[model samples]
Target: MLGPDGIKDIAKMDPREGAALLEAHIENFDGEAAMTMWLQTKPKILYKGGARSRFAAAFHPRENKFEVEVLFSKAPTDFHPTCNQIFYFGEELELALKYAWWAENRVPAEAACVLQVALPASKMSEGVYVDDAKRWERLVWHSRRVDSHGQPLEAAPDTVVSLLNERILVGPICGMSPHVVQGLPRGGWQRLTKIRLSNNQNATQVVFMNPRTFVERCEEILWVLSSVSWRGNSSQDLLVMHGLRVQPLNVGQIAAS
Candidate 1:
């Protein structure tokens, strides 16, 4: 979420794109307003990660499995402490979708766009702990069977659990709901325009334009993208998506030591 200051910096850096995009924005309002409109309706990025990181996954429904091996950027320093557990290979997709749905619900109908989000590097799951504990496996079972407070997992009116009894105890299916699949870092379930590599690294930013893509990634880490900068290492700028009105856990919010 670029504040007045952040947006101003963009205007300074890339006047061409900034002015062009801003011109479109101003024209949309019949040129009646000034900078306020741009500030209020900031572009919500679908996702922003490095070319090498795992931004998207190819899901083969026929095979009932997906493949994503690209390493992701680490969680931000500020966000690391808030994360309770890192996700595994499959869990990341499901969690991201759930978070996207949650965020979409909170957005006001009149609001030009959903709130811009920001994430740190530390929050993302490091796949799984590389040890004998098999913590990732255990966590998956626990998440399916119990709530954060250790209570039984409950199903809403028409939740995934309600529709399939198997999902209650078992983890999500390889070919889960489209909602989850759409959250892939590369974009939604279907490939839109193929993004080609260009001299400008920012060109590939669209790979994550699908709102769901950001949602799932963010949910895994429990962070909301606040703002994005196309300035330096684009990979470092890449952050995760967030759950709906879900307030991210913060150090200040936790009980004092």
Candidate 2:
């Protein structure tokens, strides 16, 4: 996995160079192969305890939609195939894959697997709906480390951004109550997804803004991963700079299993 030094190296380059480099890393690494290796070789260190175990997203051009499914050990699997979140995408599969890699590299290994597999059995139509207008770019996410009881463990809100901007990169292990919201939208409509990461060494809060186009979104996400100070406790943090490949199975195969 890529490390903080790798990210810092990319940050020194211009955006175009940085993006190209990031793409190279993503395309070259095989995320599925890596997972197989870990599952086979290092069985005990699979994922952060209570952290997400599997995540997968797919874009169906025919449907013009994107679906993201997250599976946590805590969530009940008795339902058989789990549900996911759905949103519309204006771009093609290539862009979807790029964003997928970026997201996969940002978190720990277990959560990162979401990038490698396709949840065919996971029904898309059954997933929760996400407003396309309220895309990931539209909101800023905020996370803070907290004890099991859920309290801010470090850094004030005013200091968080600067701490991120300046590379302070300090926060709780496995974020506490992480929430997102759009800047312009006020009151109730502004809020987005909120979940807790079970580890420490991460930012308490995060936010997002949508770009005008798909390429712009990719560039912005790459830039953030390359430059933003990440405080993940695991080595997977900021590893997007390296080659982490994913072999997403087809919908039919996933569904059959």
Candidate 3:
């Protein structure tokens, strides 16, 4: 995948030379600058040793208003489909595909396949949902992971945002959701869908965002996710750079997936 090294190569060139490339490529360029965002969430285990999903968002910068979904189709981190997905949101096409590729790589080949070919396939839907104000974006997703289901391992508040800018004042575990008038609004527990993994069809469903944000345009997601994928019992770490090669993402940047 085209990575940080590739991003700098474009900036090192003469402004006029790079500008020509940007003009024909980057749709969101401003003056001599171009911006993109990357959003990420790592896989978390709920049932101790069974099911897992990359539901954590590791923050980094890229662009804005992007959508993504990685399939755990084959089991663990398996190969991804080479097709770029068309989605309900996001402005960049190439960036989305690159992000999905990185996600597929993060998963183990077995679980990844189960997530795709088992869980969601058993209970077909347009896709998973998170009741909120965000319009689900499906523009770029390609995972080959698979999963079967049970009550997802319960998650606490901390699992929502790993690096919250400020600590949330959550203490009362006994109060009802709509408890106060305007403290944090009345939201129930996180929306969890119990997907049944099967040995039959290939279960698959793309993930969506509730509210898209800056530096989350898709390409950046590749970097942040690759970083998170290094978590394990091992002492050493591995680095994998994700890249895209589409019409818009293929401009002045030099990289591949």
Candidate 4:
């Protein structure tokens, strides 16, 4: 019965050994239920797409079995999204540090291009939005259990409607590349100059600079993003950046502590 304590023990073990244990008790294991229990344990370091030194588990519907895999890198060809839904819980700064490390090591030069295209200047742009909608439709079609004659066992009209009405949060459009001033270190700042809207052509460029290391910059970006209040339509109410610059006051003490 893989209880909460067992899940905690598995979290502490080597991924391979933990997976072996899970496979040994496969009949009694339940992936979704176990994932809920695992999350309740609140592990500080987890990798989403099976990075090394983390535990990832998933349920295979076709096989009707729970499978556990050691967290490790795969060739881009071998990656599967459903089987890689791992999560980590930690301080925001710690997560940002991991992102910075991954950005330095794993993120390729082409990633910036991909990010730029994925998040276009126009909200209803014809690139990522279109691709994502098609993907969602395909997923809905595949999820239905149908007979050989192509009739669904269950009704799917509501699911299709829900997909159509989904509100995607395409974040603010800003300069994709960070800029470094003359005297600053290699780590640069991101400027959120203007917000692009249909009728708002005369919007002024508001520059916000942070001359911190890559990790600190990543942390700041995460903080800003999470702090945004989506309740109001006004820019000031939406993204309240009142005291964002106050981080510099204690920047030197952060590393030491």
Global lDDT scores for all candidate models: 0.25, 0.26, 0.23, 0.25
**lDDT per residue (tens digit) for residues 35-149 in model 2:** 4433333211011111123232223323322222222222111111111211122112222233344545555523331121111111122222222323211212322223344
TM-score of each: 0.21, 0.22, 0.20, 0.15
Which model scores highest in lDDT?
A: 2
Q: How do the residues 77-173 of candidate 4 rate in per-residue lDDT, one tens digit apiece?
A: 0111121221112122222223333433464411100000001113222211312434433322322223344443335455444432333211222
TM-score winner, 1 or 3? 1
Q: Which has the greatest TM-score?
A: 2
Candidate 3, residues 1-257: lDDT per residue as tens digits?
A: 22121122221334354335434434454533322211012111111011124422212124322223221122111111122321122112123223333554546531210110011121213233322311111011111111233111222233222211111111111111211211222232222122222332222223222112211233322221222112232211121122322233422121231
Task: Return the lDDT, model 3, position 53.
Answer: 41
Regarding lDDT, does 1 or 3 come out ahead?
A: 1
lDDT of 1 at 91: 21
Give one digit per residue, the lDDT tens place, for model 1 in 1-257: 22112322221223234334434432232222323323333422222221211232322223322232122212210101112222222222222332333333344411111122233323222212212223222222222333345442333223222222221121221223323322344312232221122231112111121122333443222222222223331212122222222122322232221
